[model samples]
Target: MPEQFIAEESRSIGHAGRRELIAWAFYDFANSGYTTVVQTTLFNTYFVGVVAGGVGGVSPGLATLLWSLSVGFANFVVMFSAPVIGAIADIKACKKRFLLWSSIGCIVSTALLAQVGPGDYKLGMVLVTVSVIMFAYGENLIAAFLPELVPEEQMGRLSGYGWGLGYVGGLLTLLLCLGYLHWAMQQGMGEAEAVPVTLLITAVTFALTAAPTFIWLRERARPLPEVSGERILAASFGRLRHTFREARRFRDLIRFLMTLAVYQSGVSTVIVLAAVYAQQVMGFDTQSLIVLIMVINVTAAVGALICGHLQDRIGSVPTLAITLAIWIAALLAAYFAEERSQMWIVGNMIGIAMGASQAVGRALVSKFSPAERAGEFLGLWGLVNRLSVIVGPLSYGLINYWSGGNHRLSLLSTLAFFALGLLLLSKVDEARGRAAANNFLACGDS
Candidate 1:
């Protein structure tokens, strides 16, 4: 290629045009309701106390075990399949198409959760698994859009902007659900009746909020020639194999992913269990549980927005390291806290750590990804994170079960994950990784 074209392409490297960036971030706003309502607060408790207990009369311990195992299974599926699907999306230039179908899958399944009631634990489990799978796919698909929207320098801010807004979305959804739950109980509805309605509310929120993403965000990658039809699957695997064979080029990405896997395990565990801990350990009832989560969302939004700017100035690794240290400290505080007031402090700390760590990790992956293979690589990032989701919750569930429901002891597992993550983070070289990604775009792809 001529030097003129290289110069022009370099000049074109900046933020997305028009409202594309806003639309992209709004997708985060759209999907967060599912995780907030279904995964974290309402449904998990309802599933354990009502659905699992109704027919066969499952032990609460066993119900939690089942819930954790189910979460593990769903993420396990995403863990192995995300890379191949991502590779396909890149080669087909159909990231939007794939995202749309996954969104539909999640919305439909999530709404169907309203149909679950007493004696419907099996149905609940199946729907939960399907919704989670769809949600994970959509999350990875939308993140693949990140590298297309901004240059590496702005990635942290953009990523942080989305996460911060996402927490607000989560907060709003929880407030709506909390209000409805309160009204339902006032109308003489019990937990069984009120909880399923919240699931429906979450589904509707996701669909309505996600529309702008499909309408406004453009698919920028051109499809690779001959990588269509039946060959798409073959090409996806081929791409994965090629990526692995080129391991030397992406060594830092590999290292950082290992770091992410460890730390995000801790994060995922907190997300999955926070409500349960509040309810059981902190003695929070439903209304109080919802309020606690609302506080977390507020703190998380602040952390994401503030640390995003900090990351741009100080670099991603340092920002991530700081968050991990916070996580370890928060876990220790949580373990020792005997009062609800103390747990509230610990919850806010976890929220801040959670938002910053997640935002920095996403932006750092964007820094390391080659432009043409952004989808495939972020898919790999999803793969590693999903695997952590499996390990994190399952480990916590097992500890809780083995220790006779001792949640305090189980909290130690999250602290260990953070410690391991911080150590592994030191091994990654951000500058070298960015240069390698740029060199590929400049020389290999061109």
Candidate 2:
């Protein structure tokens, strides 16, 4: 915590290196395949359209609500498990081991998704629940290692590369899946064939891409200090308790988390709902939806790359402020747009801002936390994210359900979240958070 130590830690960034940064970013690429193909595009649509039944056959509102709730349920399980496991990993300095176990869960869950059949609603939902839980938890664990690699100032740009790469990975996966789906359809395959085939591809993608983390990632070399058998269990619980106790003192993080909960819920809801809105509201065909998503992902990749540098130059608070304003406008446009083309325009704008918002947010958290306990803090951040996934969809579902099945009002609700977060964020001091990050890095030297 001394000034000399802080200066030393700051100086080490150039020497401490870029290999860790590359490895960290590669993890994003690996995980994004599942996020794009399995969770977002293919599986979610298949689950709701095929298993839960289509919007026409079932109450689309209810179907969506169920999917959202399922993700929420899965996230809740991760929320409880993640921080404790993270704390243990940190305490044991066994980040690599944790990554290995979590990645296995991710691969297995994706494979299980392929086995789900039509009308197997129960089985499909269960698979979705477990798959997302594993995926999210693994991402959280991987993120905990990031601050150990980069300097405080470079975090925004590094996070941007990771997020941008993730979008690129996601875009690639979606394109491949679309191509396969198109070929299958051309071969006289039905909707059933497209869904299962896509799921299988996702399973294979996760299995193959997960190898890099195990092979390339290196943790700081430290002795494996011994502890009593009973202490391990006690330490996990103690860490969890300490996290909650620590929250009272870290009021800024608590405030940030609260804002993130509301706004990110809206952000994630929009991401999940965009295709549905396009399909049902705009009356776009499947091919058009895929094309639109591809466009958005491409734009997002570009945006993330651009904004990642901007975040470093101008700082995260300012970058976040601008992104939220853009989101507010996009939500308003989605609510009022009369034609399909307009949706594409708004989607492009949303895509441009999405990666930057998330990448900067991740960097912000990393900037504010104690270096050694990054995983524990990220666990709380994940908790908010998962909890919001529950709230956003449920709210959208309820509003749509109540409005005689109109989604316009549901889309409008996002404005409230964006506005609230903007207001709260106005009060956050990014400079202080940066200083805290620097201090945390200094702590590492001790």
- Report backbone clashes per prediction: 0, 0
TM-score of each: 0.96, 0.92
Most accurate candidate by lDDT: 1
Off by over 4 Å in 2: 1-18, 54-57, 221-228, 437-446
Cα lDDT tens digits, model 2, 114-200, are 777667777877888888887877888888877787776777777788888888778877888899988988999887766677776
Model 1 deviation from native, Cα RMSD in Å: 4.2
lDDT of 1 by residue, 21-84 (tens): 7788889899989999988888987887688854539876777778888889999999999999
- Off by more than 4 A, model 1: 1-15, 54-56
